[model samples]
Target: MSFPHVTIEGYPRVGANRELKKALEAYWAGKIDEAAFTSTAHSLRIDTYRRLRDLGLTEDYAIPADVAYYDQVLETALTVGVLQAGTLDEEFTLCRGNADTAPLEMTKWFDTNYHYLVPEVADQAFEPNPERILTIVREAADADVKVRPFLVGPVTLLALAKGENPLARLDELVDAYAAVLAALAADGVEWVQVAEPALVADLVPADAELAALAGTAWTKLLNVDNRPNVLITTPYGSLREGLKALADAQPEALHVSLAPSVLAEDPTYVDRVLEAVHPETTLVAGLIDGHNVWAANLRERAEILDKLQAGHPDVAVSTSVSLLHVPHTVTAESNIPVDVAGWLAFADEKITEAVALANRDEDAFARADRAVRTRAESERTRNAEVAARVAKLPEGQVQREPQFEGRKEAQAELGLPKLPTTTIGSFPQTQEIRKARADHRAGTITDAQYTEAMKNEVAEVVKLQEDLGLDVLVHGEPERNDMVQYFSEQMDGFISTDNGWVQSYGSRCVRPPIVIGDVSRPEAMTVEWAKYAQSLTDKPVKGMLTGPVTILAWSFKRDDVPVSVSADQIALALADEVADLEEAGIDIIQIDEPALRELLPLRKDARPEYLDWSIRSFRLVAVDAEPTTQIHTHLCYSEFGEIIDAVAALDADVTSIEAARSKMELLTDLNEGFHSDIGPGVWDIHSPRVPSVDELTELLTAALKHVPAERLWVNPDCGLKTRGYAETNESLKNLVEARDRVVASL
Candidate 1:
């Protein structure tokens, strides 16, 4: 068996229109049995394999053997022996958890917005479970689909874990990987891709140390007896010391990314790559960008492919990363504008494009060139007003006339108590709420009727919060679909989709709005709801808006302009909403920037500029506010130590964070430098379990050791949109009870 010249790192596992999501959720809820769930997952894998073959990737090892019931990391953990679970239900419990147990902690994967379950690396005995991998391989082979297994490499798995140092047992881990590879080889597998993305990341360890470990891991894995050919992949970041280590190991194939997200480099980069790559090894050039949906310039990429092929004896065409980040296909979409649709390529299109590039199909290249040229020349692509407004923006826009102390003094008039309780905005979106939204969308209900239903939901939320004794209230966001999509749908310069759903985590998918032009807010997005909710409550209600950087990070980025400029334009649009909120008498505004830390450039040298623009974009939202208005912001689901200064620089009156699941671990990073009033979440809302009053009190009490009682607020780790009403109600009751206990003790 030989390595395929055209290959993809992975395909979208969740089916088009989220068939897998529905099936998984149904299985979790016990609506579908294990057999049914397995059947759905089996069908998805078969469909993906057939899709690759249909697109001319018929060669052995061309299709990726990556399918996960929940997450790739969780699946890798199971396959490589780090996690030992007995059954399918038990495995799902490891990620989603039972009502009695808390699941694994999850965080952003690399610089991407997708989340992965964090592996817990305690003193558990390591034993390989190759059944899951072998079964999938066997099934695909039985279906006559030759595939390559793509997996999380040992070094990366160890580096990404949360407990005791797993790298100390690298030999044991890599040996376990060897056994799995041997099993696959026995099952007729020809190639396996071991993803070591951490090698290119900015880890706590020095590059030299990680590279040494990487070299050791690869040397053993590649040399394993009776095993498939090893393909070592380092996605997202540009190659540094990681490349040298892999090149020295002389892997069967070395995959390098040319994604636009990687830092632009010198024209001599191809020469350097040729010099570093092993002479006899296959070099898989990831010429297609997988992180975005925009079309690739085939003419330009073809020339680079020519140069690379001239240098290496064996060169394959592939995407820079997995198509899991994108939707299933553009063919399923019908709502996109004609020119924009012509200039777009989803996961399926990307696979065909890879094969076309590998075969040097000139007609495909010409069609791509024409579409690219048309997009470049389109009148709708640029807006003079947007450019001029951003250009003429005043200097020191992020600087506030009033610091936190002055703003805190002004906010004192609201008489919020120490450890004032609040949610992170959004209550449980009940079935009725969902139905109302769906009916409104389907035009079954009049606009006025829908408004009445939403107002009723808001009123119920306010009264419910007051009864629960929460000091601050939120509108529960029943009218909105997604935090980012709600704003994007109302604003200019973005396109909404009917079937574009990319998996954010397990069964949690987000349709990222496509940014096609200059951004502006033609109208207020949340002011009416905020105003109406405030009218129903004497306590201050938060006027919630997703922050500018988060809005940009969550959406497909606009490559035509720098991200900083796009973020600024979005900030200005949100600034208008902020002003409207103030005019409508909703003083406490929470602008959520949960994706801020996730979007930091992987290279340390490139971070300051990103932080400068991202922080400035966030600060720009509340810069024009009066001193009496309290501006709060939130950041979550990431390690924030690298950007703690930027978090402080947000100049928010209060800052809430996702700290509950990690048990206030983020406080260790804050120390005395973070001066904003802090809310370390008391409940892990992502999980279904409702915590006891005692548990919330202990977390709040621990947080008090890090910050003063006066500066602390109690809240959930994030919005409760995905949670059920029963759990949300009980959780808030326990949270408020815990806050009262802590306040009385103080």
Candidate 2:
């Protein structure tokens, strides 16, 4: 039973035990030296390659040794020597910008939750540092694994970057890439995976022109002396417009994702791709899902592969994209029910499934079939009462009584200042704050001691805000581990793990809670914290809660039921929490739905259903507020151009969005049609640089041209949980001063 050749597009770099994140954080915190950090990272890379070899993938079938210092995009920049300097401090500052340096812009990685540092191109001849890629290849070869080096394609790299006419510098970048490719071939590497994910996105005329130029550049690279075989891989969506350009490039191989793309739903999409692909090229059919945690349906996947192989016997099997998006394995999850656990597949299990599919292993297919059946039965009987409650939800449960004007009049009685300033929830989870929580968890300190420490911290933060002349104050979230995990910890039907960490960004990780059954709040999640913070200040305190949509998006939700059902249950629980906070005499509540736009479907035709349920879940929690309660929601890491109408329909009295990165360019869509009040963030909190008062004033002035002065609120882009205390203080002071200036001008 010889199988078609199988390969992994890329493997997760956050070590099986998350050693990379631990090492990086320790080095950043000054707990470990650079030598120690590099040793740990290098050991993890060796271990990863050895583990893959043990899994029976070797020789030509082995995956390339693709490890990142932080993110793959940032790795690409380092490999190409794109930064001004190659020092460690310069690299760190490039990703996490300092006071004197502006960090590269960050965005969601092509419809996935992972964030990537966008490359910044300038007027310089880019040079290639083949040492990084060459070092990994040599390390993997030492472990007896033949590897193909991976690089982010030049076109995708340029398309995702910020600068003036980045495409104009394509020829120089291509030359650098060709040099790297030739070096890999010199090092005995036979194949290289050049990922061009931008090809899968919807391309405009400018983008298409860039794609054409990229194709021409790659064609030149293929002709380079001693160049390794190039396999262009595009994942996450269709390459409808860019496929012809890619075909014209005429690489040795091309990989296309079948799931989450047109090939899965429309047969015509496969036919079209086959028609454009060159006859001499080997087509790698991405049959297994890389982004999700579901076990592959091997039987169905085989059917699709059979059809593909019938036309082209050169087709191979692979994962749709990199397996970095999912957890490493579900084998360690002992608390979840066996039936549900059997239905789940993580990164490691997906790799095993891919090999089984390529070999057409009957025993593995039978086991998968049985597990699928068990999961279906388990899902049907798991929560009949909750499902019935969702089915019977009354009409208009998602709509608030009284329109914007009525709510505004009631809210005005609180007497907040014009152009009022507020910090996004959270001050800083400083070392002391984190230690207090860790000590409590380890039973090294008494619960009473922990509570007192948190209370004192809250008091300090409250006084700091008051001294800074802020109109609204937050408790600084000293006790919260994360926005979503905090509420999940207090709720029923959620399971959390000790080492379930997944990389959120460079040196930051999140342990996503698993929702196994019906969700309900056993007690109020945030009322005590909000009440305590309010007790210390005369100014209004915003009760913060992670909205239902964010909770659902961030958590490992139940698969037996639709996500909408889980979202509804969470919403009902939050609606109860909202009522409790209002009864606790809290006048303002902010429900942060930062993931609202991130969860929208990539395909335009499939967006309405998702938008409907997502908006409904938000409304279910927010609409229950009193007229004077002043419900607010915050969104981040999103562009509101296509979803502005849906955002307006959420009916929040006020919506604060991430606008500082694009300099409030997103407000152009809202200026003409949006009716709700807005707080277009006056400063970018993602960067470490403290914005000046003049900078904030300019942003406020820009926002005013869109949102009227009366409808505008002054605030930072997002939560302050990731910032330092000194920077947070300086930024907010500037924000308040900018607000005062704007009021005086009016």
Best by lDDT: 1
lDDT of 2 by residue, 631-711 (tens): 888988778777988888788988899899889998998844576778988789976789999999999988888888879
> In terms of TM-score, which candidate is strongest?
1
The deviation in Å at residue 52 for candidate 1 is 0.9
**How does candidate 1 score on lDDT?**
0.87
Residue 679, model 1: lDDT of: 92
**Tens digit of lDDT per residue, candidate 1, span 1-746?**
55888988888888986879999999988899999989988988898788789988888878888888899999999998899889998998998777787798887888787889999888887899999898888898899887787789998998989887878888888888988999989887888888888987878676678889999888878887879888888888677787889899998899888875563632445666789998878998988999899888888889889989888888999999999999988888889988889888899999878888888999999999998889889877788888899888875546866888888888888888878889889888889999999999999999999999999999999999999999999999998888889999998899977788899999999889988888998888899999999998899999999999888888998877888888999999999999999999998999999988878887677788888999899988888998889899988877676678889889899999989877898888895668899998889887788999999999999999999988999999999999998999899999999988988898
TM-scores for all candidates: the values are 0.95, 0.89
